[model samples]
Target chain A: DVKVTQSSRYLVKRTGEKVFLECVQDMDHENMFWYRQDPGLGLRLIYFSYDVKMKEKGDIPEGYSVSREKKERFSLILESASTNQTSMYLCASSSTGRNQPQHFGDGTRLSIL
Target chain B: AQRVTQPEKLLSVFKGAPVELKCNYSYSGSPELFWYVQYSRQRLQLLLRHISRESIKGFTADLNKGETSFHLKKPFAQEEDSAMYYCALSGQSDSWGKLQFGAGTQVVVTP
Candidate 1:
């Protein structure tokens, strides 16, 4: 079974605080992604990394950044948390091949107070 | 721009009754469509993909290119089938790593 692990399932942070959400996959997948899931907005991609030290911005990447220092790990960083950023964050990974299904980890629900 | 739309926010059905969840997409290329399900307290997982053309748990989805839709259907709904269903499309040119998802539809199966 493929396993994708998230560092935290639930988190609360104060406004203007810096936050980190970590994700790791054991499948040696070359593709990793960060998305924020909201009530009516659905899942919006924040950022993604196709290789270590390489990252690309997604549709809603204005408030988020990502780091892929290692092949198996990808991290999402919130430079300054805000109330509007409170939402469920999901981490996903897929192989290098095109049209491959993405495997998701248990989401991390973040709340910014 | 590639996009997916799930028309219904909620759908209810009785056990053994037929169920259908509508999904539509807008893309110029040959899109690969998929249905993903997330059960309560469970992670989101793939239920079926259009490319496979196979039924999963008696649920099937057919891609109608003419209509730009890929709707999920089940002949009989079961209690265990109740879950949040998301319609997704693969946009390889944009980013092979991520999947664009719909707002999702909540299915409730009554006994």
Candidate 2:
């Protein structure tokens, strides 16, 4: 079965601290995405990489950055964490084909204090 | 702009009752619609896609292009069926990924 895994299931960070959320996929999918899930807001895409070293900004990319040094891993970076940034972060990956379903990780519930 | 909307925030029903989750989209071209479910403590997963036209877990959805709506329906609700459901659409552009999700609906099933 295809699987996506996150580095942390829960995380707490202080304000102004830099944070990193790591994601890895075992399916060798070419597309990976980072999204923040919140009540009422649903899942808003933050950043996505279609290929290694290639990245595109989603609808809500402010206060976030991403890096894809390897094909299997994608990292979401918060330059300066804030209380408002606290939410459930999800990582997903899919194959190169269009309209294919994305496989998601369990998610990391990040809290910025 | 392409968008998807799931107006209801919550739906409550008794076990064995029918359930319907509505989804509407605003897109000019042919749209690819999908329904995703997230069970308690589980990751969000695809329930079904309009293109596949297959039933999953006794649930099915039909895309009504004239209404621009794709609603999910199940004849009977199970206690385990309670979860958050999201409707999504794909962007027609050249972008590699195709997921523009709705606000989501939380279904609560009673005994």
Candidate 3:
């Protein structure tokens, strides 16, 4: 069984504040992803890291960034959190192969006030 | 552009009735389709994939390239089978790590 752990299950932050969402995977997968799940919009990718120090922007990369200093950990950073930034953030990891299923964390419900 | 479309937002059926969730995709290259399910208060997990061609939890999905659709079906719906189902397509060949997901369908099984 694979374990993907998010730093927080529920988070609250004020507007204009910096926020960090951490994720760690025990599977040591080579690919890590950050996505925001919204109603009627599905899961939109924000950022993804293929390897340590390598990052790529996804569909909804604006207002967010990512860090992958190590193979097991990936972090999402919100530079200046706003009310609109509130969302359920999900972290997922997958092996370095084609059609590999992504393992997801429990997700963090973020609230920006 | 690659896109995944799950037209149905909600589906309700009796516990013993059959259920189906529709999914479609638009991509120029070969597509790898997948179905993911998220139970109440649980994380999302893979239900099945087109490439694997394996039925899981009594659920099966067939990839119809002619229709560009991959619809999930189950003969007998169970209360525990109720969950959010999402259809996803792998990104371009060069970017297989990325996936485009559908809006998802919430299934409700009534006793």
lDDT of 2 by residue, A51-106 (tens): 99999999899999999999999999999999999999999999865578989999
Candidate numbers, best DockQ first, in rank order: 3, 2, 1
What TM-score would every model get versus the actual structure? Answer: 0.97, 0.98, 0.98
**lDDT of all predictions:** 0.91, 0.94, 0.94
Instruction: Please tell me which model should have the higher DockQ, number 1 or number 2.
Output: 2
Residue A58 in candidate 1, Cα distance off native in Å: 0.9
Per-prediction DockQ comes to 0.65, 0.68, 0.69
lDDT of 3 by residue, B1-111 (tens): 998999989999999999999999998888888999999999999999999999999999999989999999999999999999999999557354688999999999999
Model 3, which residues run further than 4 Å from truth?
Answer: B94-96
Question: How far out, in Å, is residue B18 in model 2?
Answer: 0.8
Which residue pairs of candidate 3 clash?
none
Name the better of 1 and 3 by lDDT: 3
Q: Kindly list the per-residue Cα lDDT of model 1 for residues A19-107, writing each as its tens digit.
A: 99999999999999998988877888899899999998988998788899999999999999999999999999999755678899999
- Candidate 3 falls in which docking quality class? medium
Q: Give the poorly placed runs of model 2, Cα more than 4 Å off.
A: none
